[model samples]
Target: MSKVQAPELKKYMDKLLFVNLQGHRKVSGYLRGFDIFLNLVLDEAREEGTADKVECGTVVIRGNSVTSMELLAAR
Candidate 1:
């Protein structure tokens, strides 16, 4: 059967997210904490590497201690 796509997904854009943290415990529940987490992550990623930054429709993070992260289109 063919799958139907959601409208929200259609408008989704890619983003390069970043987070700065030396230890693992520091980044725990970072995203759930507040808006700052999002900002921090995006900033860190840019510092780590030279990548294109864009708006992300959705952000999913795994692992407790996140040294860094880069957001991109989930293909």
Candidate 2:
């Protein structure tokens, strides 16, 4: 299936990203891929909440749930 992500977002492919989702969930992952719907395919993904950080490997996130996204600087 061919999913097209925004041209702007394409720049961040294969880089670390900080993604904010609905319900106050924050995700940090390496952007492996994305689609037209803004759905994201992340590697070594980690989600953070008020309580703690949860590790999620090779995750595909639905576009509709994404609230905001930023490319994180590499250290």
What are the per-residue Cα lDDT tens digits for candidate 1 across 1-75? 987443232222333334544543222121222231223222222223235444343334333344654334342
In terms of lDDT, the poorest run of 10 residues in model 1 is: 25-34
**Clashing residue pairs found in predicted model 1:** 17-71, 18-41, 18-42, 18-45, 19-41
How many clashes does the backbone of model 1 have?
5
Predict model 2's lDDT versus the native: 0.86
Reference-based lDDT, residue 50, model 1: 33
| 20 Cα displacement, candidate 1 (Å) | 4.9
Look at candidate 1 and tell me the lDDT of residue 64: 37
Q: lDDT (CA) for every model shown?
A: 0.33, 0.86
